[model samples]
Target: MDGKKQNKKGTGVKVALIAIFMIICLGVGFIGGSLYPLFQTSIFTKDSLITDQLLSKANVISQYIKSFYLEDIDQEEIESYTYRGMVAGLGDPYSAYYTKDEYEKMMESLEGSYCGIGVLCQKDEETGDVIVLNPFKKGSAYEAGIRAGDRITKIEGESVKDQDLNSIVAQIKGEEGTKVTLTVYQQSTEKEKEFIVERRETENETVTYELLSDKIGYIQVSEFDEVTANQFEEAVNELEEQGMEGLIIDLRNNGGGVVTTAQKMLDRLLPKCLLAYTEDKNGTREEYWAEDDEKFTKPLVLLVNGQSASASELFSGAVRDYEIGTIVGTTTFGKGIVQSIYPLKDGSALKLTVAKYYTPNGVCIHGKGIEPDVEVELPKAFRNSLDVPKEKDTQLQKGIEILKEKMQK
Candidate 1:
């Protein structure tokens, strides 16, 4: 009877242990099954939640505006504004988004060929009125009685008052064979006159050269564009043929244009040295060097002023750093940032500031202009006088004087 009781007690203990083990396994399986669906959902959805949230909010706002706006709105313009506003929010003055038309017009301008009534216009600093710098002598504007010193009042009968100069200029540019009407007030006549000028393809006048004196050549580079380097070479070669012993490069008031054109010009002037280098946001440096062995060895003088900028600063800075030429005038305009244009798929573009450039000696002229070796300021009274004699243009006279001195050396 004692053995039988012991065996029954031991068997009961073993059965209790097995029951607890089965309960534990069931509990674990139940919990895992409950969470597996949730885990799968989170894995697939969490990564895109933020993107979905933003797009949902934008869609809601767009729908609300379209449904409750005061009047019918242009959805296309609204979409364009979104892009423009996004770029504007960056707070970079040089970063901009251009429409198809704007991009094409700008490219044409850079290419140094465009269809427009050939007249250079600028807003008068004091009057805030659009003034004609000059009508191209070979263009229809000149043939249509437009002249320098005329004030532009209207384009195509739309008053240009309170409009930006850039917009007005764009309005004047169009496809070849188009006609643009301009109403202008000529100071010579003291009356408003209208002219219907035909737009035609014309070469931009980027470089103008003349013989300042015997053996002294003067070349004025208005801006660096597609044709600038080639035009400059032609002028220099012609001057050399004329027994030119020295050269004066007038870059005064030249707001910079194409950077490559400036580089090409530097290659001709610099003697196998680093022309310039640019540093991007990634801390990568791109160095430009002069590959040409032949260079202009004659005495060279570069003229600059407060309006000289961008590529102008590059050209003058490199020349100054290399001791290749003497800069004569007031300080430059001090724009050292370089812009790169990226074209969009829809014929538009983004012109953004990509890098900051430094001179050959690693001097960054971002906010500080390159100082001239000889500082000479023109008098305010004679600043815009087209007929100002050589003796009166103090800055030009200084440049001539410096070039003559360099030639003697």
Candidate 2:
């Protein structure tokens, strides 16, 4: 009987242990179910889940293309188009994705030095023809008898009508000592001409200065590049040496360039003041300032028009804010956003509109251009010409007039 009682006690102990195990497992299950939603809502997990979905979709599309595409695929071209599309989807005109070759060319352009038959050209708005603005004096194109106002119609016998400017430029640029054949329609001669020009490394001159009548200095800034700051300073110093009592800065048709170069140029002109500032998406602010070491104290006038944009607008806005100069001409192009180029490991780059820049007075001029103190319009007849004579340039004459008045004060 005692042995039977001990067996029942052992059975009871076994039953209690089994119950405890069941309860522990039930508690764990309840806790895990409760925390699952929290895990799904976590920042890290949320991003990962989205990324996984995107990858899955991309993989499916890629597999379909590989399986059923009719033509032989150029994988590299497809990859480049994919990246280009991704950036284009952002709907920002200033943002772009550059392939390896494109990125290299872009950097070369910003450096203001490149191996090419040096000629600056722009597509005529009304005629849709690429017109040569200026052929660098010592460059291959100039030596080959290319002149301003000539329309480029063919590159290497390929018709370039309606082609993109950058595409045409890329075709023109090549390895040093290479040759490029161009067919141009000369407007002055009213005849078509062809020439074969050799490419060479050329430095672009962005700043040009002259001492105008009445000791008024004239500086035309076409665009700001890496070499612009030093060139601008040299221009100013030379004009000052010539006893320049007043100045007129012509920024008409200037489409802008490197922002830091603009800031550097401003530093040479302004005394210890805030030049400009930018705020990124994260609300991070960066400020540019001009030190008090040097300042231009002469009577000043800045000329702008619809084409003066980006860094040019920044320079104009700062001068206006400081009351250092009188702005003459129509409103500016008003590109107040800033782009940051992020280089990838694969030699590609992404230029994104990362920030909105403001003037020293906290004015955001992105869509709304800066209005001039004295607005004057260029005559319709002189609009298309690359070199508008000072007498015919009503806007420039107004700037000169304003500077003279300021100097008389």
Candidate 3:
């Protein structure tokens, strides 16, 4: 009789707990129902609603992939692809999502240094061939007999035909002291050979300057990297020390890089004035300026071509607007927009088109390139040549001629 009484007590406690749980759940439901209208009206905006739908669709697709996919799935790769796709959906060609490795490589390029064989290359658009533009004299590639104008046909015994240029270059670059083999086709000799090159830390020479005839300084800028401004200033100062009376800045085939580097270079050349300005989607204007501490008051000539874009155009546009230099060669490549890299906590990055930049005179060159004061086309014979003779470079000749005329004044 005592045992039966204890069992009844235990059953009463269990029933009490169940009743309390149900009451709490009912209270929660009542509170949630009361707040539903508030949430619908304030929290769930149109954009958030659309985002919810997108997330729901993504979840459905992910579940199907997980449940019925034929092969093993890489969750990390899927997440990366999702991030890339999100950025690519914006439909802007200049914007992109970069993985950790890609972001690191990009930073290295912008910093103007890397561990590689030290050969600059470009992809031929028409032929889909990777051609060596320059092999640094002290680099391993140059030491191994690689020369400019040679076509890179294969990397590490794999054919690079129609391969992405970045991938090919990545294959060529490896850990320091590692060996990379390259098969090069020399068009001049009509010969093909394999080169065993060892990778090492190499610095990019973005600015090359020399004193030309009649005390005129000639500086060729390949790209505006982080170290470019300092190099350019040093070059200009050295040229001035050598009695440089006029200057010619060659921006031919120079695809732009860091925008601030161009601004810094302009700061050294221009006086106190508004350099350029950018306007974002909200019409918020940000301006760049050049102080009057230093200026190049001598005759200046800027040579630009169809491939001169972005920061190159910025420099050219500023020079033209200020009336400090005469712009020669063809019109610029017309990229007036600016891209800002947003770094994430995961070591990845997103480059987005942030704003449209304009010259000091408020001229936007997007889709409408900066016209040269004197337009000169490259001769057909020199167009295909990697190294055109100085006398045969019609556009450069025109620039020199204009600088001489200005100097005489």
Candidate 4:
């Protein structure tokens, strides 16, 4: 009888606890329902000056312009200008606000293909000079002899001085087979040259592979994109089937595209270890690690240059820190910050820098680039000269020698 009483007491306690939990939940629900409308109004309150002063001012200005302007106003144009102006105020070269059309093109570019001459150009912030980063293989820009390190002087007879990269790109891109003449300062010849490149729908393939001497595989990664990691995997598999003894990854003039894509490629090549990490403004950190699994264990060499940035630095920096491969060529571009795309409802978007990346060893290459294990510089004479023989590329030769030595070891 005492045991039955104790069991009944325990059951009563559990029942009371459950009842209390249910009451608390109902109270929370009641409170939430009561405050829901207030919360909504607080966020969108027009009279809340402390919370929405800037937006209110903007609305006022827009209304005034619409009411008293001399001519009709395009609301879309005003909105675009406002968004662009706000992004420009950030003073960040990497951050940009894209209109719907521009955002579409940007998306296409990130997908490893676009309808253009297929040349990646970067503007020097200090010098205001536009330089070609890379000319896609078999694209019109490549066929027209445009190459990396070439300065774009004019597009369609208009001077490119003080023109931003987007404007220059817009002028160069058009319908397929439409010719766009460009004046460029050729880095190889140190002379001005003109080329009438026909604009076409070019697919910018990020990965290309070829066989090197002694069954060595040479893979060039032009940029990191959504499709790049898969392409790299296929290339590696094919090279392995071809009896490749070593591998050389050329990242010359490769301005980085996507961070996750680079991380995926690193996961394929690196051993089980910390590949990379990132830190936000709030001091929160996120790390990327690899498991001891199917990683490419062959002798490897990576080629980088001053143009290799962001994701390129992530790959090369981790490779050096982990001692996974021999990094050859000059220092990388040293862009450690990561950007995120926030797409607006109107098909527009904003690309903003949100966090900074670090290598596995906790080294940040923001302003200072990653130093290579073997430093090699390509001669300026062979920079933009597509016809230059492989023997003349000293950097490539150094990479090849390093890989061969590693293979022997």
Candidate 5:
């Protein structure tokens, strides 16, 4: 009787919790319903400052523009003021609403096809330093002495150690043949040096592969572009045919591409179950999972660095959650926000941060990158050197060590 009573009490508690949840849900629904008509009917005037407080701001901005703006200030400048105010109002350092032109640049850069230095950037959580990892060979950064592990302390004298990754990249970017002065710090030293690197357009080579000693396959994913899945699939097929045992996916300096590419890669690794889902503000959720688990049963290692961001971080984080393989490198780039790229009627597009993403284990890497199994720092002495430093391959060495141990076992 006592046990039954206890069970009844627990059941009652659960029922009460469910009731509360449903009540809250209904309340939200009611409020949303109340607002829907207001939104649809254009109840609020468009030109009348969006918010009450903004009326004062709009007037002030109007006065300022009339006094200081060059020529007769057009709607474009006014709209820019509103956009700037929106970002400033959010009070979130990580979130920025990009304009059409800015969004186009972002999308182009994400796909690794951009008119700027071809490099990847991730941040140091402890120091808040933006790290440039593994600049593409013969690329501007590579030619300018930036390497796999170099911290960008400042851009044009503005310290980026406290700035967001996207902001730093924006400040550093420009047209081809133009120069951006970067104050870079090496991992081994406190002294920083200024490097004037010229900007250039990069035709992205999204994927590359190498056979390591006929038993290991080295696959490098520079970014997650539309073609990333095809390149990866082709790589796996080719490597498997050529006798491969271990695989290493180097995502160093890879500042994320497309989320869809990440899904495809996850499908290649995980079982045919739910891998991840994202929830939106309007209470919508979409699920994704692996298509099949019978693909590769071998050992895998994902190589990340300060610059491995977005979709790359998602892949590495998911694999880590599943315990499928080891992520060996420095910390990853913590850009977990999912941006929606919308094409306008014109040739332009808008990329806005709609929602953030999480790993299978529910880790949000928005500002904190994934920790590597083995933390590796490149040698400061050789970070700016032309050739790969002998002792600076801590991440790669750790990967090789772990792979060899797994092979031995």
Candidate 6:
């Protein structure tokens, strides 16, 4: 079976999104249960809480690895004797202390821009289907046949059901030119079939626009990054100069980028309305205001899907609430929590959940995602994708139909 593996460079994704503190995994909820009381703040400092048992375990592990392990152990590889003991002592699978290099890698992902498969992917909680949010025309996944709403149930032989999103990403990403197999479930047939996808480099952050006959303009936003707001602004200005009327802001499969950038886009779109709101601790709140009057007041249609999350969720929530545009597609990724990266005193950092972002309607889409006015789910069979479809894309056809009606109006 042949399937295309989407390329993902471990660079620009916000690992700890503010999705209400989606942290510590669904595991290791407590540290050593009863033993944790022995190492509480009252008894021990935050650093040295390990018992002698842990130290002995670390020594045994180190000696065994050095003498009998298959791989060679480097002398400088160890952090500190205390650190080794700490890992052994924690007894919590979820809690981990990263080395400096690992810590830096962890922090670099928050900018939300990456060079890989141009599609935003998310696991459907109900079906465990891997759905694409949006697709970049130039990326390999788009070229392969991954569509905005295609659900993947199996990666090779591994069932993706209940697997974490990170695990799915790891299975899909690899060195360029490698292929991964997937059993995609199309909405038409509702039966799973296998397909192999080869990995390739995916570069994004380029907002392209085109005149779609007369005053209608098509704007494809690849991904939101540090400069997306500015880039989209320029694109809007050019389209307006060309006498743009209906604007199609394609955010399908857009896993979301920076909140500030999304806020910038909202500022450009909603104009004077309350674009977005975030709440911090103790009733503290921050509201993002529009930068100026709305740029294009024409009928706008936002394309979204299950992969639309974080910043994109914020944008869609505001648009739907303000009635600024028609949000077309399936329900969006329910990620309402906001996370702010806190730089720790040590070289490592703490990516803690900071606040909850609510849409203008005071709706929280963290666990419950946003529902589109028009619901167009893909049938479980017959090549369902926004990329190059083996059959037809009901979602795209519906969007175009809705946009056409809006244009006629």
lDDT of every predicted structure (CA atoms)? 0.66, 0.69, 0.69, 0.67, 0.60, 0.58
Lowest summed lDDT window (length 10), candidate 3: 16-25
Give per-residue CA lDDT, model 2, range 1-409, as digits (tens). Answer: 0000000111000110000000000101110001111122326555453477777998999999999999999999988888788877887655667788865654453232336776655544335466675677868888888887688888888887644344456567666777888888986798989999998876576788999999999999877655678999999999999999999988776656667778889998898889988877899988888876789889999988766777788899999999999998888766777655566666666766677878999998877778899877677776656677888888888888888888889
lDDT of 2 at 4: 6
Lowest lDDT sum, 10 consecutive residues, model 4, at 16-25
lDDT of 5 by residue, 1-409 (tens): 0000000111000110000000000001110001111122335665654777867877987889788978876787677557666666765443444556654543343332235676655555446676554467757777777765577788888887554344455566655567889898865566788889887775445688977773888797866655578888889889988888888888765666556667787787677756655555665655556777655678888887655666777788888888878987677656665544344443333334556667777777767778888776666654333235434666666776777778777
Per-prediction TM-score? 0.73, 0.76, 0.74, 0.69, 0.63, 0.59
Question: What ranges in model 5 sit over 4 Å off?
Answer: 1-42, 45-49, 64-75, 92-204, 341-351, 382-392
Off by over 4 Å in 6: 1-97, 107-204, 213-215, 382-391
Per-residue lDDT for 1-409 in model 4, tens only? 0000000111000110000000000101110001111122225455643446687998899889878999978878997888788888888765677788875643443221224677766565545556775677768888889786787788778887754454455566555656778899887799999998886765657798998879899999877755679999999999999999999998776666556677789889876788888777998887777766768889999987776776788889888998878988877766777655566666776766677778888898876778888877667766544334678888889988888788898
- Between prediction 5 and prediction 6, which has the larger lDDT? 5
Cα deviation of 107, candidate 4, in Å: 5.6
Model 5 steric clash pairs? 122-306, 134-148
Clashes of 5: 2
**Deviating ranges (above 4 Å) for candidate 4:** 1-90, 97-114, 126-129, 142-149, 153-199, 342-350, 383-388
Clashing pairs in 4: none
Task: Score candidate 3 by TM-score against the native.
Answer: 0.74
Q: Output the TM-score of candidate 2.
A: 0.76
TM-score of 1: 0.73
**Superposed Cα RMSD, model 2:** 23.3
Q: Which ten residues in a row have the lowest lDDT in candidate 2?
A: 16-25
lDDT of 6 by residue, 152-259 (tens): 788778898755344455456554566778777655566666777766665444477877764777787755665568889999999988988778887755666556
List where candidate 1 sits over 4 angstroms from the true fold.
1-69, 100-114, 119-134, 145-171, 183-194, 345-348, 384-387
Candidate 3 structure quality by residue, lDDT tens digits, 147-200: 867877888889876443444555676567778888889867889998898888
